[model samples]
Target: MAQAKTTLRTTAAAKAASKAPTNATADKLVGTLRDTMVSLVRRDGPDLSARQLAVFLTCYLQEEGHTVRGLAAELNVSKPAITRALDRLGELDLARRKVDPLDRRSVLVQRTLKGAAYLREIRSIMGETSTVAKKETETRVVRATRRAA
Candidate 1:
């Protein structure tokens, strides 16, 4: 009976210790993603705030045929926020506005060549960062599993 109790305690303690690293890994993942995103944005030749990047990316997605409502849902932002972003994008000439034929009251954002080129550049930069991050994450998981074992 004493042995069984010790075994249970040991298992529970191990589980608790293991959870710490898992949480750390989750935090690291978010940080890595943010860093990589920031780097990619810098490659656009101008430093952009995190909010700006999010707004620009949302607009870019919209230019690719996503509806404003869909973008708002995906970004978890309001329609007005999306509209403001779209206006900024237009001011920069990174996107174009087109009247939605089916909905005369609505406009569809379209990506201009500049926007397309910037996206392509960002993708090229992300390729390396993504590969490195994936490998590092995999390595951390393996190490955690070893400790758990």
Candidate 2:
């Protein structure tokens, strides 16, 4: 019962946050996020959970090499959680894990060719979002100007 109440409180907080007014930049960023998500879902690509995508992007974007321990620490998640996400990524052929040559005990997370292509796709989708946001902003400006004239 306590757990259920905590869950309800969390849900209420989320709803309140959504209703909170944000600055134009924050609103625009959220718009971009929404559009990007819609594009990804419309495509036939593998649907990833938020956690999986976070792990994927962190591994790909970071200059430093990634290990299960490193990833967990970087993401503030548990090792098992990282492993689970990696398992899904491996299943999708988007990423792979290899035994580190320097330390056999440690495993390294490496990027796959498919993962690179997927990152490219994400970039393209974000670019499209930027263009759409620009158009929307311009339209708003035009409407405001017409009202003033």
For every model shown, the clashing-pair count is 0, 0
Stretches of candidate 1 exceeding 4 Å from the true structure? 13-28, 37-46, 58-64, 131-149
List the RMSD of every prediction in angstroms: 4.9, 9.9
Tens-digit lDDT track of model 1 for 55-146: 66776654367656766788888988877777767776766778889988777767788877776766776676667777888998899999
Judging by lDDT against the true structure, name the best candidate. Answer: 2
Give per-residue CA lDDT, model 2, range 1-149, as digits (tens).
99999999999999888777466678888899889988999999999999999999999998789999999998999999999999999999989999999999999999999999999999999999989899989999999999999
Give candidate 2 regions above 4 Å deviation: 1-22
> Residue pairs in steric clash, candidate 1?
none
lDDT of 1 at 49: 51
